[model samples]
Target: MGRNTRKRRTPLAAKALAASAALALGGGGLLWANFHASAHESHHDVAWGGNRTKASTAQVVTISCPDVGQKLTDVPARARTEVAGELAGLDRQITDAYRRLATTRDAQARDAGFVQNSILQPLQDRRAAVLDRIGLEVTRVGGTVPTGLSALATCTGSAADRTTGGGQDGGGQQQGGGQASTGGQQGGTGQQGGTGGQAGNGPAAADFVDITKVQPNVPAKPRRTRSASTGTFTTRCGVNTNKNHNTDNVIVAPGVANGAHHLHDYVGNQKINAFAGNDTFLQGGTSCQNRNDLSSYYWPVVRVQDGSQDFDQDADGGGKEGNVGRILTPVQAQIKYVGSPTGKVVAMPQFLRIITGDAKTTTNGLANANAHWSCTGFENKVQLTAQYPICPRGSKVVRTFAFQSCWDGRNTDSANHRTHVAFADAGGNCQNGFKAIPQLTMRLVYDTTPPTLRNGQVKNAYAVDGFPEQLHKPATDHDDFISITTGGLANRIAKCINRGQQCS
Candidate 1:
């Protein structure tokens, strides 16, 4: 199986508050390009990448475990204990293998080895053996095993033609592969990808592969999106599609590089990230829907890799031009306001400098996998493993982003630049103690067919225009802020998104 991996800006009142917050394929089968966010990636939404078919329809053979649910049948409880021990052991092996994926030396090759050696084969083999024993014991005790027990016993997928949305056959923990074999049905919005290539062994006893394993696929989840609009009127910060270089912060200043080798498309506050303080941002001009927003919103410079260099790709002349060679300009930057999820809007903490998408990635290692990527219709997306989905002919590839909206009600810049705030759920709800702030959501779009290369390659397309030594390319691509958007920004968000007003 493979693993892998939008936006807004705004203001408001009455309700103010909170906000917040990969890939790789291992092995020689596919030479996955290098495009992944780093540890900035966390254990949150794990919706994977790739096409996926639904549950299988193969008749599930049953072998229910008799009253075994009562802890341990007359059999020695050691069996359960042994299972637990095996799980711990297997987990450690996975952890160890994943650690090697991040190593700077031989990263890509390590990932492949980890996938084939550590995960793919062993997970289905060694792990399944332990589970197989459990199942064999059940029938010995006259246990009428569940139809899927044969597969579940090994924490594997069911080797059957599934019923799309019908439940799993073997009653194993869904997490243990969840019978995740994707079939040949093409998928996306209305398309359902195919099922897994059933294990070579006969159906009833084959090792059920995970949906993600057989095919680096993810089950479809609702694609959560919020567009900015009013009943009869809607506007974006009138596109300012130019490469802003002066504000590129090339002084080799603190926190920023000497000269960001990449470029960022600035929309809001005319002047920002020029190493300005909060007051400077509050005073800058804005192109927000109404031109009143003073809140500065900025991100990595989107560039068309046609060999056009704004500043030297290597300002310091280190001879290393972190240029990706042929990148494309982002079609548009959709900036909108995000408010509290619960009810009334919460106030945003001031001078918040939120950085999304890692900017320090290189072929060596991924500094952050949270550098999110997805298409127009995908709700549940993957991270890191460069599982970029190629948008169909007319569909669009979108980099949908959600900035941290929950403020600690204190400093904007944190020691690490992120912990100072949090984000809300799709429903706008925030966590405890965190005051909700009108968040910024930016959805950068690319309208062409995905290059056979991929969206990760797209990310690798251009670097953020900053200092050369800072090594802030696709990984260092991030954003900064200073709220000055007149109260109107927050009000509008509340009325439309929060209050159930369907405005796009």
Candidate 2:
């Protein structure tokens, strides 16, 4: 929805946009997953991007309604005040079903019937028409829409920790059998009937070790500039130059386009995408310096184009210069990590994907403040624009990425992804209730010069692989990841981050 920057406060942490209210999503929907935090949650069994639902012709989500009739007793406050007339009645029915299902201990017994009937069925039947009405109503209301409005469209369940802007909750059972973040380090729990009732635990000297936060955070982040080292407990993993990709546990449908948009640059376990299972690569091989490291990492390929330049989307027919041709592999990659207070490392969840940068250069197109762009020798940096500053005589251009290190010690991903993970402090320390993992730091360096030949025979840069029907431009630059890293590797990194070892 917006730029894929790390959340900045400490719920694991992200700066509060407005102190904790319901979250706002792409098309004006709000999501709220009021779940308590927990600790036993190591990795998630769901897809990489969280429990998000898409309108699929090939895949149908069948939900059964409660035995209760299609009437309602109480209406949501937002619906009462914000929703208009006939639509208001429909909104109340939807909310009432959710309310019943929310408190029903045996909700799962219906075969996810409640969700299929209440949320998905009507949505599927009237996709275009319903969305149109929702959009119209959202505009009439000053700021709020019906609270679960977007969730119906997405089917990501009732909301877990907030992740993206859409506010889709990942708490309830989504896609049949997947775990949502019930409780995290702060001692919370999920609301689902399956594992929601299970008691959480503290660190055991046995298999599950506690990863504490680093204090005084070694090196503080420099103001207005990127810090190479916060002197934190981050370590670098290995990167392989192999050509392989696997799609299993992800949420991909045979012909759906929502899961992945283009060709991906994969590191570590080869099999990954919207359809790869979490266990697919658990014992899989790696292309990193350490063969033991199995964390899967992926992102859209960066095509170095003989640009007509970016940021000129509507201005100069420069759209053709955005991205095209074959997606190229990174010359080399480096895996960086950050640690917890006690400097213990835990297993990263599956399908943890983050998209940064805009795909187009239109002023009206969505862009993020966190999308950083700069040249090696030039001190100035840019964000969310297709425009790139020319580098000096021999310097290279770069895209520097810093993923969140601190986790809530529970959920693998929040609705927006960033909520369960937050940015490291200036001191590189996590927030009060959060634990630290290996924060991801990446740099995709482009040093090649554009071709000088003609016949219109000039060189062109390509974005990640797609259907060739569209171009993947600079504005759309982003990254994807899968946690296939072995458990042993995590512990060793914990040692390094704890002892402050700069292990490669």
Best by TM-score: 2
**Mind giving the per-residue lDDT tens digits that candidate 1 earns over 392-470?**
4566655555566677776655423455565554455556777666656676777643332222112112223322222
Steric collisions counted per model: 116, 75
Q: Which residue runs of candidate 1 sit more than 4 Å off their true CA positions?
A: 1-235, 246-261, 304-320, 324-327, 361-368, 377-389, 424-429, 453-477, 487-498, 502-504
Instruction: List where candidate 2 sits over 4 angstroms from the true fold.
Output: 1-126, 129-241, 245-258, 305-323, 339-369, 378-386, 425-432, 450-475
Per-model TM-score, in order, reads 0.46, 0.47
Tens-digit lDDT string for candidate 2 (330-446): 554555765443334454554443333222111112212133334564323222122233344576556555565666877654433345565555455567887666666676666
Estimate the TM-score for candidate 2.
0.47
RMSD of each: 19.0, 20.8
Candidates' C-alpha lDDT: 0.36, 0.35
Tell me how candidate 1 scores on lDDT.
Answer: 0.36
